[model samples]
Target: MAVGVPELKIERVRQNYLANLVAAIACFLLEAGWYSAFMDTWINGIGRNRQWLENTGINPAIQYGTALVMASIMATAISCVTQLTGKQTALRGIKVGALLWAGFELTTLATEYIFEVRPISLFLVNAGYWFFGMTLMGAIVGGWKKKV
Candidate 1:
């Protein structure tokens, strides 16, 4: 404890692991669909083509594993925030997800896009996916409370 800083007491928020797992799986699936739908646009945005992508030698497992892990982290964060803010509910989770997306994800991506001079279409594709994905995760985490 630093001088003049009051001790902070944080409540233990019980998390539903099942909800987090389900939420992460849902987001992972959403990522697959979203990318598939915007495949051409996304590839073109990065100035690449199918041949280039295939030749990149990146393992699909690594890509998918990363996505799932990220989704899980996001789900847990949403759950924690939702519980901390107020009663955890599907509606509240949705709101938190949207707010977090706009506040953190959107802002950070916008900065990167501006500096990298990336296409607006690419930004929309990526950002749009997160918007929906986060909300979905939030809804699950918020609506499914861990039994105390």
Candidate 2:
């Protein structure tokens, strides 16, 4: 992102909210695919298997809602940063995404895995998803800066 963007405005932030929302959803979907594709590996890493997951039940509503909200917040934060940095471009978004991924996603997962003695594969899968997801998020939020 640039370092000399125009002054921020409420209207502009509001306009970008939609873009952030959409990006978040896309990122979330990417996450779902990533996990699904590597489901067996992930489950095994966490000391589980297909049979366990099939029997274990989670609150779908809470899970989906939490995921959605997390994605939305991430996208919105990226969008805001893109504007503040004065680099409201897809490329800038990618840069921001990488930063966010490293700063937040990678760090968090690494810590969790380290403490839990989780598999490297699990970390790889989770980290990879955030890296790509954040970059794509930046691309979408930064690319769609026309309105803002």
Candidate 2 lDDT over residue span 25-131, tens digit each: 99989988989998988898888888987777887778889999988988988887777777588989888889888888888989988999888998887788889
Cα displacement (angstroms), candidate 1, residue 43, comes to 0.8
Error of 2 at 73 (Å): 0.7
Give a tens-digit lDDT track for model 1, residues 60-142.
89998998989999999999998988989999999999999999999999999999999999999999999999999999999
lDDT of each: 0.94, 0.85
Residue 109, candidate 1: Cα error in Å is 0.3
Residue 113 alpha-carbon offset, candidate 2, angstroms: 1.6
- Residue pairs clashing in model 1 are none
**RMSD (Cα, Å) of candidate 2?**
5.2
List candidate 1 stretches off by more than 4 Å.
1-9
Query: Against the true structure, whose lDDT is highest?
Result: 1
Show how many residue pairs clash in every candidate, following the order shown: 0, 4
Error of 1 at 50 (Å): 0.9
As a whole number from 0 to 100, the lDDT of residue 104 in candidate 2 is: 82
